[model samples]
Target chain A: MQPRLVRLTVWAAVLGLAACKPKEAPAPPRPDPADAAQRAAAAFVHCVEGGNAACIRTGLPHGAFDAFVLLGWLATGSPVAILDALSRELVAHSDPRTVQGRFVREVERLSGPLRGAECSPVGAQELAPMVTQLAQATKARLEAIGMASADMMRVVEGLAAEAAEGLEGAFLVRMSCKREPYQLYLAMVPEGPRYSAIGLMPYLPRFLGGDEAQIDAAQALRSKSLGISGAAAPVPDGTVDRYLPIPMEEF
Target chain B: MFASFASFLLAVSVGLSSGAPDPQARATAAGYEQLRGFATVLVTHLNRALGTEHLPPFVGAPVTPGLIVTADPSRVQLFDRFAVPLSAGRVSPPEPSPECASKCPKILFDTFRRWWFELGVESRTHAVEVPDVVLIGAHRDLPAQTLTQIAYAASESRPIQPPRLMLLTHGGPAGVRGIPFYLVRPGGLTLPPNSAALGLTVTIEPGRFVVTAAARSFGRTLSATSVPELVAILKDVHRHHPNKAAIVYRFSGDVSVGNFVATYAAVREEFPVAVLGDDEPITIP
Candidate 1:
């Protein structure tokens, strides 16, 4: 009886040990680098689309103006040359009482709040009114800077209205805008991981061509898109079509 | 007894099969996809009437997405993948020259000031000298004759010293056109010892400068507010090495050319200087 009892206890102990043994946990999947980038890009597009002033301003990367200057440098020879030219232009109308000074002050007044505002999302209704106010103020300021042409202000107003309309439905894609003299390649690629939608500002003109030549170039760039969108069939190349009216399943 | 042991093995297999996926990781991935979906709903309508001519496509964060970049004009393409690295917008390293073979050491040439440059080596023990033949990593946009012209100019101006200066650059020669000539002056610049290089970034922020060194021997960054102050700091940082240290200058895109030229002049007035062109590598010790 004692031997049989000992055998029962040993078998019970083996069963208990087997039940309690922990399984090997699988290694966590490494997050895709593209996913994070795409997310950052999406956040930026949403900020712009929604007119979240704070998001837009905060999203403006540190060297935002630097790209502007460098793009100017491409045409003006050097950053110093552009600065000097600007200085000369400013000094020509140095009087704060002059139209130039008022224009500068007005621009400063309009832009200061946007620049210093906290990083937060604003309501949809809030942005459209603010943008219209900005557009009107901008038109007024242009007149101060001697751009008071009826045609010019009309064009500006027309453009502003069109812009508001364009924001109604816009999808964003990541295009690597590289200029000549490769270092400027950083023109759109930020220094660190954070994505800034404004880097695309320089390329927008090219993307939205004004002339036949500009249109051709824009078409060429669009042809290079990775056509993942099902709306348009993929070019013989593997890249997806440029435009997608509907959301993709990959998302 | 054998049947009991077999039952224990079956129990263990059941435990392995029951392991559940971590909830947190799945949630994070799902959140990323949702945000991506929200941003990607509608394509920016092609409306040229919107006066968006000045605006290019929206700038995107750096992403390669399995695309290959070509060598000449160095544009990114979808097909024809290769093993070249993509960093800070630079494509490939200078194709290793036959002359360099294993011994080739790269140096950063201020292609802006073709005459000025800093020397690098394959290793610590490598001997130092100026090579008569320097290779310019030209963009395909650059004419082929540009290489011959640069080589001829370099050969013509070989310094009267041993360790012949072979001036091969890791940066493309075309991009230097935008750099202000005065910002990187050619005069009074010295050839630093082959030991280590120091990095200095001139920024758009008024009076702010960031000094950096990548070596464990040196700490990462030193900030300075003025040219005189920057010079003093550079002097103090490299005091031990004295003239042995080289300065690699990186300019913020928005940095006023005047400020950059001032800081660059002050530093180069004392140490050898090379402006970083096209994502060139810098060394520090």
Candidate 2:
């Protein structure tokens, strides 16, 4: 079933945290993995909430931020992360108005168990102006290219109820892009006072497009037919189809 | 250059070679005339065996350059390793009729041995270069294995060769893993059959060096005899960084050279084929 994209000011506690900005409070230099995961998720959610373009440079884990750029290409083929590619022509000549405001309203809301997104290296300082130009001047271009719009961006979408999950690790935060053929899985590993979001692509560049329906149907059938209620249903086609696990007959 | 095949019909069906060396093979080293004929047959047969339908210098492995290959078979396809056919010309066979059927093993072994001599290989009387490695598939008997190694050593530049005597296992018969040799099963003479032995692959895991048998077409689990020498070689080569041909021979129930040919072709059909050394070949479940 196509999930309804409901806009809400407040959501279930389990829905996860958003921009809980505390003014002038710098996160600790080295946060624990648990703390880092919360901090990373909040940062990503906060940035997406306001189309916080700065997240690309300093907000998310440097590795995750870099991955966003790569994933953007696979997700939309729109060059949403093209500004961060450091290309001379696109960097200097591309407009920057659409992305600049994303830097604002990015106050860190560090409530809940999620913590410690402060340890990882923020992306290049030089990339700020370039990102600003892309976010603002090229807002439509960004959307056309599958860049996450400010409104559609959220840390956890649909109570984790409406959306299909790809991975769940002790420190992983994964969400599928409902509109496009992509999903991102980020991880929080031991590194700083906070968890490092290095190697975030568990389901690296997972494409959720044409194959999504087949995969979902197969999953649903397994969950329903097998009477597996509340349990995680394994993808039916492990060896064959990404969405469908091997046929029952093959068993 | 068209590859001339030294056709040796396996005199025994899946049975070992008859205990007789080919007179033609013996006479091959006798003079320059015989040398030319041997060279042609060796090159032509190897080129096809090695699947070098096109590569110019389609010199099959172990046999170095400086040797010539000819094919008197009019239907002979002159090609290189790349599968590209080369220029074809009518050439004469060295003799009136193809040499009579002789011991197939001795022919192949003798052919390789003659090439070494023609290549001016260094040889010692009492001590032939030691064969630190034993090719299980190449020889069914022990003595011929040693003798084959005698000529084979010139092909390889080994320092202190094993004594020309009984073949000793790295471990015991059960433990002995001879050098990695591919047991090319009876089929795969045509194309990459559902089962064609390609080569051996070694993957180093956490603490162990894992060796796997590779084939173009993989389905069934590959089986290999476990010998200590193979294991020793795997342990030895694991010390190092990791890592086909249609010769159709019609045969009946007769245990003639066809059986040996088909069998030898099955294993040696593809040289450099890796036999599981450190461990027995296991079927991937």
Candidate 3:
């Protein structure tokens, strides 16, 4: 009986040893760098195309403004191809009387000389006179309205600031008037980053109806939406349709 | 045999007790609770507007209540079909006009803004505000004397050498408009313009100097600096301006690289500076 008990104890010991031994963990599948990169790129493209704000927030590198701009373009349907085509077309046939013309003239002056001489060369002597005339005309128009010189100066300074940045390359002149609404399109350029800003676009309601009150209201809304001063007020629920209103007013 | 059964029961109890709440589940629950509260408020408002009977208090939080309205067209259609008839007597269904089409949207937007403001205030009360830094970059080379004057005026500790300079310039002969140039110095030095190249340089003192130039013009006369040396210079700058909140500079229009540099600067506890155009002084945090 003692011998039988010893054999049972030995069998128990062997079982315990077997249980205690570490099992080999399945080797982790090696990550494919190419696949990972492809996934990342796909996610980025999807976020840009889908215009899903949550997906954009998740896919973008944190605090990246480029991602924000790209998302904004996607949301507005102002992709790179559209923006570039618009810019080139505007540049080609822009008449000086229109807002696009004024911007094109300004860009031409600032950029020194475009490689192709599609238009007559603006001489150094003519440049200052033209700028002075434009400035004077702008001042007169502002005076005709209630806007103070300070406000006009602020607008001019803001536009100049934007031009100094590389934004001129990416954005096309949409429309701008001294007292009217200003709009710029982010042209779809094949190279580099692109974004469009419809500055004072929401306020076009005022220009449409000639209602100063509506314009003021729209301006306030634009400022809050753009988060110009600080953090933009969060988009209110059920107000998405307000951004793209049917144009009722004629130029 | 009874004791062995009791021991097994005890072991199962212990195993069950050891399980912890899943963090993801907890977060989802919290999110759902917030969504439910928002939905309740929204539904309550709609009910009041429609003069419908109030809904009973929900037993538990609702998940994706909007989905219910979307998935069930009949529910939304019922509201839409009834809205005109219900309001027809009290509020005359005004003739559709182009003006109304434009103005109606604004009224809706105003309501949304009000709701958003209330939500934001509520969130803010619960949210923890964290300190953050903003970094600005500029291609223009700043004068050492100007920096010294500002440093003296501010009464901040001055470093022995100038901070490493980062220059943004056009990339090459191809004339790529926006390319960033990074220059580093182990010991700080003032930047001086490269007379022969399309760059600016400043000499802080003997053996201390800083230079910025365009990439197309970055050969022969222009001296190159290492990345480690630039990091060391930044570290020295951090040492001197220990108390300042942010460091702002002008970016060369390269947001990605610029943000990275800004983050690096912020990590050192210096506030990133907003780079305004020429003549605008770098706003020290």
Per-residue lDDT over B165-208 for candidate 2, one digit per residue giving the tens place of the 0 to 100 score: 11111222232112222211211112123322233443322223
Chain A, candidate 2, TM-score of 0.23
Candidate 1: which docking quality band?
incorrect
> CA lDDT, every prediction?
0.30, 0.26, 0.25
The deviation in Å at residue A107 for candidate 2 is 20
Give me the runs in candidate 1 sitting further than 4 Å from their true place.
Answer: A1-251, B1-206, B283-285
TM-score of chain B of each: 0.31, 0.19, 0.21
lDDT of 3: 0.25
- Mark the regions of model 2 whose C-alpha exceeds 4 Å error after superposition: A1-36, A39-46, A49-52, A59-172, A176-183, A187-199, A204-251, B1-285
Q: Per-residue alpha-carbon lDDT of model 1 for B15-69, expressed as tens digits?
A: 3223323336525653222212111111111011111121122121221111011
List the lowest-lDDT window of 10 residues for candidate 3 chain B: B67-76
lDDT of 3 at B207: 28
Return the TM-score for each candidate structure: 0.20, 0.16, 0.17
Native contacts recovered, each model: 0.00, 0.00, 0.00
Better of 1 and 2 by TM-score: 1
Per-residue accuracy of model 1 over A134-164 as CA lDDT, tens digit each: 4555555444323334543443444345334
Residue A212 error for model 2, in Å? 16
